[model samples]
Target: MAFGLVRIALECDKEEENKGVRVLLEELVWRTYCNGKKSGFATRRECEPKE
Candidate 1:
């Protein structure tokens, strides 16, 4: 679940800095459960964020 959320946030905007990744990860988790089922693994392709 953490991986899925992080992947989506990373895909939203590329963040190389450690802090950026941290912030995005945190936000991902919050927005997800906060909104109820906002985050999830719908498909295999959805799990991978383009580089």
Candidate 2:
């Protein structure tokens, strides 16, 4: 039963990966994080250097 649940979770993750859902999720996380920050400086994520 636990293995079945893990398989389902992985399948759902694969589908979302192909649909670029991670980018959307990251955008939401970045926005929420920036909004919660106390600094007034720049907070845009696109300007961040790719590591």
Candidate 3:
């Protein structure tokens, strides 16, 4: 069996949005871990209109 985990970090600006409430996930960074070891890293990015 294999085990995996992912940790995400979000960025928020504005006190009103941080009142112990949910906020929009505009940007974030994530790290993946497998078998108790770091595996990969990823970040949120905007895609171009023309793919």
Candidate 4:
């Protein structure tokens, strides 16, 4: 039998000056639930040019 897998990708903006430090920043992400249970949180940010 084959199992199904789910993948998610998030894009964020690259700061002009700082690149490494931006990853540490925390943004409030909305929570998602499935079957009356918490599933995950979703957050969005600016996307980089390469991304």
* TM-scores for the candidates: 0.15, 0.14, 0.35, 0.32
Q: Which ten residues in a row have the lowest lDDT in candidate 2?
A: 4-13
Q: Estimate, for each residue in 1-51, the C-alpha lDDT of model 2 and write its tens digit.
A: 333321111111233455654543343222222333443232335555764
Which model scores highest in lDDT? Answer: 3
Better of 2 and 3 by lDDT: 3
- Identify the leading candidate in terms of TM-score: 3
At residue 20, candidate 3 shows an lDDT of 66
Record all residue pairs in model 1 with backbone atoms less than 3 Å apart, i.e. clashing: none
Compute the lDDT for candidate 4: 0.56
How far residue 29's Cα lies from its native spot in candidate 3, in Å, is 1.3
Ranking by lDDT: 3, 4, 1, 2
Better of 1 and 4 by lDDT: 4
List RMSD in Å for every model shown. 12.3, 14.3, 6.3, 11.5
Clashing pairs in 4: 12-46, 13-46
Clashes of 1: 0
In candidate 1, position 10 carries an lDDT of 18
Q: Candidate 4 regions off by >4 Å?
A: 1-28
Candidate 1 TM-score, true structure as reference: 0.15
Where's the lowest-lDDT run of ten residues in candidate 3? 6-15
Tens-digit lDDT string for candidate 4 (1-51): 866765444334455774445553464455565545666777757889999
Q: After superposition, which runs of candidate 3 have C-alpha atoms over 4 Å from their true positions? A: 1-24, 34-37
